[model samples]
Structure formats: C-alpha cells, structure tokens
Target: MNVAVEGRIEKRHISLSAKAKAYVALTKPRVIELLLVTTAPVMILAQNGIPDLWLVVATLVGGALSAGSAGAFNCYIDRDIDRVMKRTQGRPLVTGELTDREALVFAWVIGVASIVWLAIFANFLAAALSLVAILLYVFLYTVWLKRRTSQNIVWGGIAGCMPVLIGWAAVTHSLSWTPFILFGVVFLWTPPHYWPLSMKYRDEYKAANVPMLAVVRGRAVVGLQTILYAWATVACSLLLIPVAPMGIVYSVVALASGAWFIYETHRLYNRAIHGHEVKPMRVFHASISYLTLVFLAVAIDPLLPF
Candidate 1:
C-alpha cells in the first residue's frame, strides 16, 4: 500500500509539471526576453538617463502581459500549423493541454488587462502602443503574412520593434527620433537573426507550409541576405552613438561584436555554397549574442563615461 501511494504521488507530480509547462507556454519567454531587451535600453535613455521606479515596474508588467496575450493568440491561430511543426508540436494548443475556448478567453483577459494597466499606471500613449503591437503581431504577421510570403519575417519585424518606442514614450509621454533609431536597430536585426534559424529548420517550415525565406528563396539567397542585414545592423548600431546617450564604450563594443557577427554570417554564406547545412546554426547563436551585447552596451553607456 505504501508503494502504491508513492506511485500515485509521482503521477500527480507529473500531471502538475505538464500543467505548469502549458501556463509558461502562454508567456513565450524567449520572445519576452527580446522585447525586454528592446524596452529596457530606451528606459535607460529616457529623461534623467535612469528609469523611474513606478514607470519601470508598470512598463515591464504591462509589456509582459501584452506580449503574453499576443503569443497566446498566435498559438490559437496556428494550432494546425503548429501541430505539423516538430518545434511547436508540444505547445499547449497543439498538445491538447488547453482547449481553444480556454486559451482564447485567457488571451483576451491578458490583452485587456495589459492595456488597462498601461493606461492607468503608465500613460495612454504607452497603452495605445501596446494595443497596436498586439494587433500588428496577431493580425498583420500571423494572419496576413505568415502563410503568404517569404518576406513575412521582414515585415513582421515592425511588431517586434514597437517596445523600444513604447518604453521611450512611457516616460516622456511622446515619440522621438531617438526611439525611432532604436526601432531601426531592432527592425534591421530581426531578419538576419531569424533567417539562419529558419534555414536550420527549413524542413519543418516546409512541412508546415510556412513561406520562410529558406523555403521560397533558397538557403544561398537567405545566407547572402543575412550577411547584408548584419552589415545594416552594424551601421545602425554605430548611428546611435551620435544621437543617444551612448559613447565610446558602446562604439568599441559595437565595432568588435558587429565584425564578429558579420564574420559568422560570411561563414554561413560560405558553408551554404558547399551545400553544408550546420553553420547557419552557429550564425543563429552568434546573432543572439550580438544583439544582447549591443543592447547591454547601450543600456550601460551612461555609467561608462567614455
């Protein structure tokens, strides 16, 4: 009887773990990290070069809520395609962990809550931007572009770029060129950052009938585009030094890291030439590091003092 009781407890533990995974899936943690990276640097650059405590707390929470809602809605819309892709097969919608109605209601609640939180605690501009981000990601990217064109990632990148501008406006309550430049940094960074990973999973995207660049344009073309975008990202990063609070430390790191990122993309290009497939994964990993470090340099430049 003791052994039977222990087995039942273990079964309950497993059940709880599965439920927890579904809840976390609603948040889309990797996407949230990228959004925060974009948002935080702008917050650092706002007004006094240090974020207000209340504003920071409200923006983070509101941003997370909006991002989570977008992710959940995407899951709902892509349930069929998601089940076809191995990478997304385990998601709550695909795995039967949550009902469609349940996920829909959860997404709506989160979306409404995010806008209300931002309007009440932050400002109306931030709240409006948050709502716009959600609609752009859900309606523009997921509904209109994902299945139609290989340029989906390129255009969908706009939704991803919204957080930086939202962060800047949250404190100052208006838009400016500074945030526009930061948006450009993220906008240009998205294609190269996502394309190599798409190449690495081309078969999966093809299976899902998603018109990724790797599927429609071929890996060679995708590699070349990745390199071009990496170069553009570096150029954009350099432009920030003159406009924002960034300084020599950011410039130095941007040059070194950007060079390394370009080198990785070139390696990917060369590998694709020989019909080899593994180097794009390396390029993908490097892109993540490059973006994170560049933004970190931006966030800390005021403290560095040239």
Candidate 2:
C-alpha cells in the first residue's frame, strides 16, 4: 500500500509538471521575450531616465501577459497550418499537448487578466493599448489576414508596433510624436526583419498555401523589397535625432547598426540578383541583433548627462 501511494504521488507530480510546461509553451515565451525587449527601453525613454523600478516590473509583466495571450490565440487559430509547416510543427496544439478549448480558455483568461493588471498597476491608457494590441493581433492578423493575403504581415506588424505607444503612455498617460516616430522605426523594421525568415521557409508557406511574399514572389523580388524596407527603416531611425532629439549614443548606434542592417539586406539581394545561393537567415539574425542594439542604446541615451 505504501509503495503504491508513493508511485501515484510521483506520477501525479510528473503529470502536473508536464501540464505546466505545455501551458508555458502555449504562451510562446520566445516571442513574448522579444516583445518585452521593446517594452522596457521605451519605458526608460518615456520616463527620460530609469523610471520606478516596480512600475517597470509591473509593465513588463503585463506586456508579457498580453503578448502571450495574443500568441496563444495565434497558435490556436493557426493550429491547422501549424501542423503542416515543419517550423511550427512542434507547437503545443500541433503536438496535442493542449486542446483547442484549453488554449482558447487560457488565452481569454490571461488576456482579461493582463488588462486588469495593467489598469491597476499602470494606467488606463496602457491597459487600453494592451487590449488593442491583443485584438489586432488576433482578429485582424490571425483571422482576417493570415491566410487571405500576401500583405498579412505588413499590416499585422502594426500589432507589434503598439508597444512603444503603450510604454510611452504608461509613463506619461499620453501620446506624442516621439512614440509615433519610434513606432515608425518598428513599423519599417518589421518587413525586413520578417521577410528573410519567410524567404528561408518559403517552401513551408507554399505547402500550407499561405501566400507570403516569399512564396508568391520570387526571391529576387522579395530581396529587393527587403532592401527598400531596410533603407526606409534606417531613414526612420535617423529621424529620431531631430524629431525626438535622441542623444549621441542613439544617433551613433542607430547609424552604425542601420548601415550594417541595410548592408546585410543588400547582400541577400545581391545574391538573389546574381543567381547565387541566397542566405536569408543571415539577414534574419542580423535584424534581431540590430533591433536589440538599437533599443539598448535608447535605454542608455537618457541616462547620459549630455
């Protein structure tokens, strides 16, 4: 009897542990991390220095919850295409680690809780923006656009851009040209950032019948588009120096990193134009590095006396 009781206890513990992991997976923690990366630095910039540490913590948590909620909805909605796509095959829903009902309930619970958390700890504007982000990502991007258009990610990218406004609003309870300019920087950055990854997985999208630019358009065309967007992103990054009066650190890092980002983009374009093997992942990785460095500089700039 004692041995059976111990065995049952161990099994239950293991089951609970697995359930926890599946729920965490449903949150799409990696995407949440990237979204949060844009959050805190903007909070720093919004405060014009380091803000209240606890407020930063609260805002980050709420933002993570909100992004996770939206990601969960994406997973639930895309479970069909996800099953077909090799890259997304390991998602919790695709793997049967969670059910559609389970994912849906989780998304709603977290989504509502995130708004309440932000409203209580942050403010109404931050809470409201978070809710808007969730709605746009789920309704506009996932349901309406994901399968319907080659331009899905272009407009869907707007959902991701709201964090700057949310962060800025959290601090001041208001909006301004600065947040919008940073919003533009994020907006222009998304295509170049995402297109490379799409190019690398064009086959998967084709198999799923998702008409991504990389799947519908040739690599040469996608590469050219990337270059144009990359240049636009750089130009927008530079505009911060005048519009928001970003300091020397931000200007220097933005120019240098923007140049590097555009260079890698052109490299991909050149390879496509020359009939050489196109290295899409190089640009993909470079985009991540560029955004991280640029945002880190944003955080660092206001702390400086100059």
lDDT of each: 0.87, 0.91
Question: After TM-score superposition, what is the CA distance of residue 144 in candidate 1 from its true location, in Å?
Answer: 0.1
Instruction: Tell me the alpha-carbon RMSD of every candidate.
Output: 4.5, 4.6
Taking all chains together, the TM-score of candidate 2 against the true structure is: 0.95
Across 1-306, the per-residue lDDT of candidate 2 in tens digits comes to 012474573322336677788889988998888888888999999898999999989999999999999999999998999999999998888776677999999999999999999999999999999999999999999999989998888999999998888888889899999889889988899999999999999999999999899999999999999999999998988888887779999999999999999999999999999999999999999998998998899899999999
Please identify model 1 stretches exceeding 4 Å from their true place. Answer: 1-17
Provide TM-scores for the models: 0.92, 0.95
Give the true-structure RMSD of model 2: 4.6
Candidate 2 global CA lDDT score? 0.91
